[model samples]
Target chain A: MKRGLITALAIAKKDLQTELRTKESINASASFALVILVLFSFAFDLGREELYAIAGGLLWLVFSFAGALIVNRSFARELPNDCLDVLIASPAPAWSIFLGKSVAAFFLLFIVELISLPVFGLFYNIHWTQNFPGLLLVMALATWGITVVGTAFSAVTVNIRLRELMLPVLLYPILIPLLIGAMGTTTALLQGEPMSGEAIASLRLLIGFDVIYTSLALYMIEFILIV
Target chain B: MREKAIYLLAILAALVMIPNLKTVFMDLPDEAMQGAIYRIIFIHVPAAINAQIFFTVSLITSILFLVKKNFVWDSISVSCIEVGTMLVLVNLVTGSIWGRNQWGIWWAWDLRMTSQLMCFLLYLGYLLVRPAIAEPTQRATLSAFVAIFAYADIPLVLMAIRLPNVRTQHPGPVLETGTMAKEFHAPFGLGVLAVFLICTALILIRQHQETAQREIDSLRRELHSI
Candidate 1:
């Protein structure tokens, strides 16, 4: 188990190092997220009450789309450079590879969310410092769940034609429950409401989703890689 | 062909089922809330049941393809998905029509309808993914993985929509269980069973034809090489 964890961490570090050098995926994702935020602000006119009501949902929407795009590109990059094939042929377990990719994606989405929150606050004129910690926690948990499943699906879909288009088609439907839970919790936190029993319930649901999806993805990753 | 005979029987069963469904709809007493047009339950309930049958078949065939690794199973899985997609589309359309009469709108973000739509889209994605890849082995393998993964969403979609907070217009499960249960029991069961058998028979026939065609094509290619 320790060896597996080490392998997973090593794989994640490699992905992070590759991104550090290229900066293609993270930069693209961040910029795309910013643009989406801007578009939403303009589209909704950013009226005070309206903006406050939708801020959580808008931020999550941007993060999810950006996360999808980044996940797709990361796998696509590894495939073309023969990195994925090399990893598959290595001594590491397949679940380790899934873990590494999922962690890398989770971090990338975290960075995007970090940037988008301030941008969202500025454009919508909402305060963030009050809910910062809770929002951060929710984003972390939600991204972990999304990336675990998204990374596996993205790896499979990247080989198909119109892959960029295919990723969202395959992803959004599955991610709806997670999105709802996350968005609901975040909205509650942002409003300074007590994390109601309902909010706590949503958090638990998100955690349950993360556990189920991650374990399932871990088991399935080997089949995905071989096929 | 034997497959054609099974399909013919399936059609005959469907024809026999129409009057039973019609009688149920005609017999429903008027309600203060929904009125006479609410009789659309006969069509809506059967369509929904058929949709579930298709989804179950798709899931089972997908597992079969993974275990058997047979091209026959792969083709059958694909055929079931295609028919399943068709049934779901019909269900959505008819459900929407029913909604219009009962609720004064053509569409509702109802849990049942939304989840059913999600199932439809997932299969559509599966179908789209299959044909785009040219290699047979790769196509089967990739599609099998997708089949497994996509079906995982069905339960989640069902849960999300069923949750009370979602504020959908469709009647709840309680409504289905009460008087509606007795009303729908026979025809609904028959419709589900008839569709299930018909779909299985159709998929088997399609699988046989697909296999035979692939064999002929491969032989032709070998001859050309010679």
Candidate 2:
């Protein structure tokens, strides 16, 4: 078990190293989020009331797409050169590989959020946060939910001829509950309300989603990656 | 014997539907609120129930395929999903028509309707993603994984659809309310029976075709090797 954790962390380190050296997926997804935020700001121009109303969904829309973009690219390097076969043949088990890659992708998405959230606040001119820790907790859980499933599908569809089209079709339906949970949580936090029952329920739902999909993805990614 | 059973089911379903239609059109009294036009329930409700049940069948078969790795179960899953998809579409169109005429709108954010719509879209997702992967086992495994989630999502979809803000046009389960409204019970029960039988028959037929197709493909490969 200790060895497995090391193997997983090693895999994550490897992915982070590759991203640091290449900056390919992170660059593209971060830029994509920025462009979307800018474009949406122009078109939507939802002043304080409207922006707050939809801020959660709007933020998630950009994040989900950006996260999908990053997830799609997570396996790009491994897929093209028969590198994934080599990686699978290595000592790491499938779940460890799934874990490492998802962890890396989760951080990548958080970085994207780090960049995008401020821009969102700027464009929408909204700021209210009584629950910083609570909000971060929700964000982390939601991003984990996104990355686990997204990374699994990213590996699943990595080499397919359909390329990018398969991701949204497969990802969005599964992500609905996660999105709902995030939206509810965000709405509650942004409203400056105390941690109400609905907010706690949403947070709990996010945690449940994180548990369910992440575990399922860990179990299933082996089947997907062995080719 | 299996084929004969399906034929019998199809015939029995036909027998039930024929009289049930009369019970709906002529025998059952008009609803107190919605009147005779509301008789559409005799058709729409059964289709909706079958849609859900058929997807549940797909879910069970999908799990069976994963556990046993049997092509037969996979075939059944495919067939049930197809029949479920068709039934869901039937439900949507009929409900939309009913809603438009009766509720003054063709669509509303009503919880059941939204969830039902989500259910239909989920089925479409299953059908759409099948062709993306070329290898058979991979496709089967991937689809099986998706099928599990698709089935699991039904309740969540319904839950998400149930917004506090939106009241539903769709009525609650008849049995849930403790009474089946006397004369309406026979037709309603028969309609559900007929629809369930038809759904089962369709699944049987489609599964047979899928099995045959698999056999033919294997034979073609054998002949080529020879």
Candidate 3:
């Protein structure tokens, strides 16, 4: 078990090191997210009240697209370098590989969210200091759930033709619950409304989703990678 | 075969139930608001139950395929999903038509409708992913994975709709259990069983055809190599 943990961390560290050197994916995705947010603000050119009201939905929309971009690139990166074959053939267990990759993707998404929050706040004139922690919590948990399923399906789509288009088509429908839950909680927090029982329930639902999908992904990763 | 007989019986059952369905339709209580237009429940309720039946069968078959690694179970899973998708589409169309007369609008993003639509999309995604892969083994493996994942998402989809903030005109859980429960019991129960048998027969026939096709293709490939 300890060996498995060490192997998992090694794989995760390798992905991080590679990203650190390249920086292409992180830079491209963040820039894309910023551009979308800018365009949306201009498009909606609403008064302050309306802008604040719609801020949560817009922020999540940017992050959702950004998250998709990051996941797509990460999965694609494995193919060009033949890195996936190495992972598949390694002595390490398959779940470890799934865990390591999911964690790494989660970290990348977290960084994107960090940059996005302030940009979103500045554009919409919404205060972040009060809700930042809760927002971050929801974002982290929700990103984990999305990435777990996203990573598995990303691997599946990678082998198909027109993989880039196939990934979102296959993914977004399955991820609707996570999207709705995250959007709801974020919207409530941004609006400065007290978290109702329903909001809390949504957060719990997201947590449950993360646990179930991650575990299922871990168990099924071997079948996916082998076939 | 016994399966064939079962299927014939299923057809007979469906035919027999049609007259009973008409009788129930005519006897339904007039709603205070919609008057007799509420009679759309005859078709809508049966379609909705059958859709659920198909989905549940698909889920079970998926689990069996995963555990047994049998291609037959996987084929059944695929067939059931197809049937389920059809049933869901019918339910949605009929429900919308019913909504029009009752609510004065053609459609509403009611909780039940939204959840059912999401369910339909999930299965549609499942169907799309199946044929995209070229190799038989790869298709089965990937689709099995998708089947499991999609089934897991159903509860979450249902919960998202059940949340309070999401507004919809569909009656809530209580209405399903309290008001419409007794009225729906007999037909729904019979319809569910009839639909289950029919779906099983269709899936078995489809599975046999797939297996036969695979055999013929292999034979042709061998002849070519020789």
Candidate 1's TM-score on the B chain:
0.81
lDDT per residue, candidate 3, A92-148, as tens digits? 898787777777777887798889889888877888666767887888888898778
Every candidate's lDDT: 0.77, 0.81, 0.78
User: Mind giving the per-residue lDDT tens digits that candidate 3 earns over B1-226?
Assistant: 8566757966876775675566566655676666776666666767777778778877888778777888887777787788788888988998888888767787787778888888888888988877778667777778888888888998998887776566778666534654554766676566656555566666667677767766786788889899
lDDT of 1 by residue, A1-227 (tens): 78988999998998988898989999999999999988886687656776667777887899899999888875787777788788889999989988988898889889888888888888777887786777777888999988987898887776778888878877777788788778888877887776667677778777877887888788867777876
lDDT of 2 by residue, B1-226 (tens): 8799999999999998997887788777777888778887878889988888888888888888777888888888888899988988888888898899888899987776777777877778888887776656777777777787777777666555442345667666542465667777788888889999998998898889988977887788889899
**Docking quality (DockQ) for each candidate:** 0.50, 0.51, 0.64
TM-score between predicted and true chain B, model 3 = 0.84
Please give me the total number of clashing residue pairs in predicted model 1.
Answer: 0
Number of the predicted model whose lDDT against the real structure is largest: 2
Estimate, for each residue in A1-227, the C-alpha lDDT of model 2 and write its tens digit. Answer: 77878888998999989998999999999999999988887777556677788878788889998999988877876877788888889988988988999999999899998888878777677674466677788889999989988888787777676869987788888788778878877876776767777777777777777787777777767667764
Model 2: lDDT equals: 0.81
* Residue A176 lDDT, candidate 2, scale 0-100: 82
- What TM-scores do the predictions have? 0.90, 0.93, 0.91
Ranked by TM-score, top first: 2, 3, 1
